[model samples]
Target: MLYFLPEPPEYAPPPRAVRVPAKLSVRVFPEVIAMSHPYELAPTRPLSFERERGITEVRFQGGLAHVEVRLPGRDVEAERLVLLQAVAEAGLPVLLIKLHPGSVSFALPDAAIAERAERLLLGRGYIYAMERDLALISICAGAMRDLSGVMAGLYDTMDKAGIRVAQTGDSHDALFALISGTNAEHSARLLRQTFGLPEGGTSC
Candidate 1:
């Protein structure tokens, strides 16, 4: 006789029930978050031409010299580099550098530095021009690039006042014009009046 064995039925586990909270509470600390990540808040009101836009101040900086180096040959780039390297080696600080096809121009802070730069150029045999007794008129504002017609207005004002601008430069917040030192005070005053700034603003 043969014994018959039958396999038992497969066991099945019951499904698990998940528990979820009916109400969830979240706490936020603004001061702690701000302390962790510091940043400046933007102005609530949009920038306006009447209030927030336009020139904020007028500054006059005198006793600067404008120098232009002319490199007329085909190796203008190399000559320009050599000239700039010489200036750097002399421990001279140049500002408002502008490059041309065969020339480079910049401003020296004072007459003493200008003289030193002139000596360096003369020693190197570079053809250059140096204009002394120049002043930089800075039209200071917030976000100057965003303001339309600022440059035009400034040029118009200067032209009307018979102030001759030798060179010009700009930053994000200010527009600069190099003018005669003799006219710096007059230019500053006229710019202040045109831009509606106070008469007692800072000038040096």
Candidate 2:
């Protein structure tokens, strides 16, 4: 049996400066046990498991599979094979476990990185909402003269709202982390009001 240790009191580690390769351990649920167990279990040599946020992520030296599991009632075998091929190609350890609905949430240690991630998600059709600690703004290229235009736009928005921006800059394809535990709708409304965006305009 595995045991989780108590968290350190009043201690929060700073985010990693550089990206490091790590394995992601996905939980497989009991209902799907029958479906998953039938496949031959392979032990990936040198596969190392790390516990992060209550999940065991399996990491390997190099080359691992990119596994995908579909939603329930969808084709399971097809999805399993997709996952298998990804793992086999990558040469990483495989972990299959079951999980309850709404049990997973992506987390980033760095605030700036989180912001960039939100932007990527926004580009991929994930709607941007508001964040209490961080405000999301939208700037169009054609409306601006140059990089300064973008900064000026940001300043203008902040100045109009009577909100002071302590630190701001270009994330360079990174995700921004606003306030933790904020809802989608509230996040969206905040962005709209702050940036003077019209209805249905995208936010990042």
Candidate 3:
């Protein structure tokens, strides 16, 4: 059995950075399982499993943008209010969001929404930072939750391919990874292969 050691939140390691490689290692697992099982119950060498493929799309949401809202005095309630207000101003939904010390980062559909969000929040005495040219890549495989290793292997494939993931979200039926427009085509191609999908699956 594998054992793990815990680390303090302050000292927790940052997420791994993936790089582009000429080829991905087909061997996802580095070590073999050492188990005392009956021969009849043992698994096959090259295991074959089933997976559901989601309708994957790499949408360019009208010039991607991210706005960072500073949390005044660590007042979490105030932060929530600011976010809700921004959403109302955008007239569109947020693509993704992340929180950091004294601030929260949001991925919006376009520069227009980001600009509007910033102006609205600024009027309320909030400080923020903004960025653009981002995108949303969602893998909508309904079989994601039902199967183990589907998501893991997906990430592994991406990591091996050197795809840069900015923000991400997932549900039982889907997975999402945020990236820049420059990486969209490559990311789409790799994801297509990762899911074992035909060309038709990569459309819209």
Candidate 4:
């Protein structure tokens, strides 16, 4: 059976904090931010490395532990070797499943170890991007008398488009990702139609 940790003891403080407010203002602001899509892990894939001049970059994929590294010059290889040795000495056991110019990645059997390794590498200034793909739409309009009505109208519009929604968050913002790029237009169309919004409603 698979094992799980309820909460991994905070390896480090969270990057940011959440704010709570008691009262709301009428002044409205329109802003949009992309919502990340959920992605499944492909752990068996091996890591790869690239180098140009004195710069090196490494790429590896796994659970939440996607990794990428950049180093200056041909010294990248040597630097990676030393870094791995140091981690091992710190009592952090990781298997060097792959090593290439500019980077190396470990295949850890435990999620806790993998997460710690990821944070350590990131804290060292290694460049990495999470594997999340999402499309988020935000709308701002004069305050509606009922928020529930706003949501109903939006969902009905999406429903007509024959799009299957995985999840809908409780916010004026709409977050949904298409299965394919070809469906994006359809999804956007559905979204606009639902909200009675005009094309190019949002500024670029």
lDDT of each: 0.86, 0.36, 0.67, 0.46
Tens-digit per-residue lDDT, 116-143, candidate 4: 7667767777654322222333333332
Clashes of each: 0, 28, 4, 3
Task: Give the residue spans of candidate 3 off by over 4 A.
Answer: 1-62, 89-92, 99-101, 202-204
Task: Report the CA-based lDDT of candidate 4 relative to the real structure.
Answer: 0.46
Worst 10 residues of 4 by lDDT: 51-60
Q: Residues 1-204, candidate 2: write the lDDT tens digits.
A: 999999879977897799766987875433432344677444444544632221111111111111122323355555444434543454433222222241212223334544554554444443233222333222333222222434554455446645554223234321122222222234334444544555464222
- Clash pairs, candidate 4, are 37-133, 54-73, 55-73
TM-score of 1: 0.73
Candidate 2 regions with alpha-carbon error over 4 angstroms:
1-132, 136-148, 171-197
TM-score of decoy 3: 0.60
Q: 10-63 in candidate 1: lDDT tens per residue? A: 998888898899989965433332233355433344444743566788998999
TM-score of each: 0.73, 0.22, 0.60, 0.29
Runs off by more than 4 Å, candidate 1 = 1-52, 202-204
Candidate 4's TM-score reads 0.29
